[model samples]
Target: MSLLPPNKKKVAKETPRNFVIFGETMNGKTYFTEEFPNPINLNTDGNAEMIETPSINISHQRDSKGTITKSVSDVLSDVIDELQGTKHGFETIVLDTIDDIITLFEQEICEGEGVKSIGDIGWGKGHAMLEMMVRVLIMRLKELSMKKKVNILYISRSIDIEENDVSKQVPSLKKKWMNIVNGNSDYTILCRKIGKQYIRKVESKRKNYTRDKIDDEQIASLLDTVIGAYEKSKKTDVKDAKKIVEQQEKQEELEQKAKRKEREEEAAGESTKDNPDPKQDKQPEQAPKEVTKEPEQSKKQPTARRRPPRQARS
Candidate 1:
C-alpha cells in the first residue's frame, strides 16, 4: 500500500543515556554537547557551525543537491564505520537537527521511485519510506552507542501539544521524523521561551519495557541537571567540557612551576669555580680571638697570726 514495511523488530535498549531536545532556534542545543570529544554530527538540515560544538560536518555524507546521494542502507553502513574509525576522540554522537532529515528523506524517495517529489508520488509510498528510514536510523544509533560506550543526543526545534481532554493530539513538529523521534528517545524535552524565562518540560511517554522506562518529571529534571557525569567515565555536562580542558591546562602549569623552583634551588646550592673561599683569603691578617680570666685571691694569714701571738704573750 505504501513505500516500505515498518521496522517491527524491537530497538535495542543498549545506550546508557539518550537525550532528545526540542527548543527554539539558537537555544543552545548544540552547545549542550560541546564537552564530548569530536562528535559525528549528522547535520542534515541546519546551519551547524553556529552551535560552536566540537563536531564534524558530515551532513553531506548522504545529503546533497536536494536529495540523498547514497542509498539509506549504504549511508547507514558508512556511518557505522565512521563511528568506529573516528580520530576526533569523541565519546558522544549528535543529530544537530532532524527537521532537515525529513527533507532529505523526501528527496531520497523521489530519487529511488523516479518521482519529482513526495506530493507528486502516486500514493503515501513516500511516507512509508520515510518511516522505515527513521526507524532504522534509531535502531542503528542505539546499537552503536551500546557497543562503543558512546552517548547520543538529538536536538530539535520546539512545538506545543495541547491536550483536548477528549481526543488529544500533541503539538509537535511535522510528523514524519517527529513521531519516530518521540517514540524512540528515552528522555524527550520540550524547551520554550515564555517571556524572558527559558522553560524545559519533559515530553511524557508510556514506552514499554522494550524501551528505557522513565517518568515525565524525572526525565525533565534529569535533562535539567548537567548530565550527571563521572570523571572516570568521561560523562560530563556538555557545558562543562571547556572548563574541564582549562583545568587540565592549569594542572600542567603547576607542574612546570614546581620544576622551575627545583632547578633554581639546585643552581643556588652548587659550588662555583669563579672564586676561592673567604676563610682562605683572610688567614694571614686575621687576629686571634681574645680571652680574659679573673685574678687569684691574696693570702692574709701571716699578719693575723703575729697579732694573735703578741696579744697572747702580753
Candidate 2:
C-alpha cells in the first residue's frame, strides 16, 4: 500500500452517529436525547412521560394486521418501515431503554414455551435466546443506520461487567457482554452520577486483547466519551489518549539514547587500541617506550644530516 503524509493521515470525517446513551435509571439521558429532535421512539418501557417529544407508540409490537404479538424481529421490521417509509418526516430515531426491551422479549419467549421464567428453561436455552436477541438487535440497528440516513439513539440501564484480573484490564461493563450493542453504534456515552449532576464518559476498552488493561483515572473521573464512528479513532476515546501515545513515544526515545551511548563507548575503546594511549600513570612500561622513542628520533635527526654527507658519497 502507498503511504499517506502525516497531515493527510490526521484528516477524517465523522460518521452519522448511531449513539448509545446509557446510565443509571432516570439519569436524564432521555432529557438529554430529546434536545436533538422529537425522535421516532420505539418506546420499549412505555415511559415517554419522562420526555416531551413527538413519538409514535409501538408499545405493543405487532403487524399491520394487529395480531397480539411480541416478536422483536417482526416488530423491528415494522419499526423500520415507519421510520424510513412513513411520511412522518422524522429525523432522529430513538430506542429507549433497550435493556427493558430485551426483558420484554425474554418474557414473551418464556410464555410461549409454557414456562414462568428463564429458570423454567433447561440446557440454557433462555441464555441462548438472550444471545440471539443481542445478535438480532445489533444486525437490525446496523441495517437501519446504513440504508436510512437517520441517526440512532439507544438508551439502556447501567450494569457492571467482570474485569480481566489476570491482565489487569478493567473490562468495559458496556462493551464486554454487549459488544454487539457498543460496536454497532458510532458513539457510546457511559453516564454516571456525581451528586446532582450527570457525567457522560466514553469507553475505550473495546478490543478482545485489552484484558488486564485498566483506566484508573477514568474510573475516578465523572465523564467519559467514546466516538467509535471510525475504528482507527478508538484510541481517541481514552481520557489521556494523546498523553498515552506521548508516553510510549518517550519510552522509545530513552531506549534510543541508551543505544547511542553504547555505540559511542564502543567507538572510543576501538580508537584507544588503534592509537594506544601513552599516559603512563596506569602503565609505566608503555610510558617508558614512548619516552625512549621521542629522544632517539630527536638525537638522530639533527646530527644525522652532517654525518650522512661525510660518510655516504661513495
Candidate 3:
C-alpha cells in the first residue's frame, strides 16, 4: 500500500537551515560561521584567509593575454558546480560577506551590457537582472542544501540606515535585495560587540528590523544553539513523520507519471512525423468506368439461319 517503491522509501532527513549573519567589521561574523559543522567558506572579500577553515577565493580571473577573463559570477558558478558534481566532505557552505558578492554581480551585469554602472542601463532593467542573478545563486545553494544535506550561511557586514530620523543597524545590502536574502533564510542574526564581548541578537525590540528569535539567551552557544532550536521546532512524532513521507512519495509518483506522459506524447509525435497514417494521407480517386452495351441482336439472327440450313440438308 506504499506509494513509493521499496528502494525509494527513505527516512526523513534533517532539514538544512539557511542563516544570514550580519555585523560590523571585526565583530566575529566570519568567525561565527566557522563554528558550523565542516564549513567550506567561499571567500569573496579576501577575509577567508584570516580564518583557519578551508576556503576558496572567489574573484575576477585574468588570462595569459593579460585580459580579464572570468568574472566573479562565473567563479561562483564553478564553485557551485564543484559542490554538485564532486564529493567533498563539507556540511556547510559559507558565503563570506554577501555584500561583495552583490557588488560582483553588479559589475558582471554592467560589463556584460557595456555600461559603467547598473543605473546606466535604461528603464531600470539592470537592477532587475542583478536581483535575478542573486536569486538564482541563492536558489542553487538551496538545491545543494537539500540534495547534499548541507547548511548555508551568508556572512554580511552591518550598515546603519537612518529612517524617520532613527538609526537602525541592518545588513549592508540594498533594501530590495535585503528583503530577498532575509526572506529566503531561516534565521537573520545580528552580531554585536559590547565592551570586549561579542553577542548575537536573535530578536529585535523595534519594528525597523526583522529577526527570528530562535534562542532567548543574549549569549548562547554558537552553532549548536541555532541548530538545536531549529530541530526542536521541527521535531515531530514518528507516525506524523511517516505520514509526511508518504505524502511526499505520492507527490513524487505524480510528478513521474506526468513526465512519463509527456515523453510518450513527444515520442508519438515523432513517430507520426516519420511514418504517417495511410488513412490520413489524401489518395487520388480514379475516374468512374463507362459501361457499354454489346450488339446482341446480330448474334441471335446468325444462329437461327444456320439452324434452318442444317435442317433442310438433313
Candidate 4:
C-alpha cells in the first residue's frame, strides 16, 4: 500500500475519555460512574457491595490481621488482562479511589524488600519506588483510554487547604502524588452538596451540574449533560450583569442632574449681577422726587403765610 500523507489523516469525533471525580464522602462519586455504559469497578475499599451492582474486589488477598496480599504489579496485570479480554463485557473501568491504590503501591514496595514498611528502604529509595509505581499505573490507565478505547474514572475525596490566604477544596492526595493525579486527567470535577441538593462543580470552567438528590435515576441525565458540555458554558449570571449596568446608568444620570443644577444656579447668579432689578431702581427714583417736592412746597408756603399774617394783624 502507498504511504498516505500525515496531513491527510482521517478525522474522527471526540468522545468522553478520562474523568476525575472527587469530593466529600457519600456525595455520589460512585453513583456517577454507575451512569456510564457497563462499568467494571476495581473496589479497593470493598464498598462495591453498597452500590447494589456486580463488582470485583481487585484488592482481595489480605491476612487475618488485614495485611494486603496483592502486589501492585499483580493488580495492574489483572486490570490490563480484563482490558484486553474480548469477553470481559465492560466498556468503562473505574478505580474506586486512587488514594488507596497509591497505598497499595507502597505496600508492594515493602513486600519486595522483605520489610514491614516502605520506610525500611531508607536513603529516599522508598519515595523513588513509590513514584515509579504511580507513573507506571498512570501510563497503563492512559493506554486503556487511548489504545483500548475504554473510559476510566478515578474517584477521590476532597480536603481543604489555604493557598495565598484563600481556602480551597482539592483532592485529598499526598503532595508528592497529588500533582500526578491532577495533571493526568482530561477533566477534574468537584462534587458537593448545596442546600437540599447536590452539585458537581468544575472550577476551571466555572460550571456546575445538579447531582442526583432525589434518586439515582437522575444520574443518567446528569451524565448526558456533563458529557454534552465539552465546550464550556458561560459563567456570568445574566441578572447580575443587568443589575450592574442599571446601577452605572443611574449614577451617570444623578451626576448629570447635579451638574445641570449647578449650571442653572451659576447662570442665575451671573444674570442678577449684570442686570439690577427694576423695582430696586424705582425706590431710588421716588426718594429723589420727594426731595424735589419739598422745594416746591417751600414756594407755596410763603403765600399761605402772608394770608395768615394779614388775618392775625386785623
Local lDDT at 22 for model 3:
88
Clashing pairs in 3: none
- Model 3 bad stretches (over 4 Å): 1-16, 64-66, 162-166, 203-314
- lDDT value for model 4: 0.71
lDDT at residue 83 of model 2 (Cα atoms): 66
The worst-scoring run of ten residues by lDDT in candidate 3 lies at 203-212
Q: Using TM-score, give the best candidate's number.
A: 4
Best by lDDT: 3
Angstrom error at residue 11, model 1: 22
- TM-scores for all candidates: the values are 0.51, 0.52, 0.60, 0.61
Clashing pairs in 2: 167-212, 168-212, 169-212, 169-213, 201-224, 201-225, 202-224, 202-225, 202-226
**Local accuracy by lDDT, each model:** 0.60, 0.61, 0.75, 0.71
Sorted on lDDT, best first, the list reads 3, 4, 2, 1
The sequence of per-residue lDDT tens digits that candidate 1 reaches over residues 1-314 is 89986869864543235667767665545555554445667666555665565444444344556555655446655876887777646667787666655566666677778888776766687777777877888788877766776667777776544222243323345765666776666556555556765555555532322213222333233344432221122368867988878877886787789899999877765633334364665558677788777776677545644544445554
Supply candidate 4's per-residue lDDT for 139: 77
User: Which of the predicted structures, 1 or 4, would earn the higher TM-score when compared with the native?
Assistant: 4
Question: What digit string (tens of lDDT, one per residue) describes model 4 on residues 142-239?
Answer: 88777776777888888997544578888887766767866766567787776767777654322332333213333335454453334446567999
Residue lDDT tens for model 2, 1-314: 75865554543333434767777766667765665544667776656555477664445556698654666656776777666666767657787766666676676677668788887799999878867877777677677767765667877777654332232222233444457776776556665667987665555423322212322232212122323312343336566887877877886787789899999999999988877864743554443444344433454454445545456666
Compare candidates 1 and 3 on TM-score and give the better one. Answer: 3
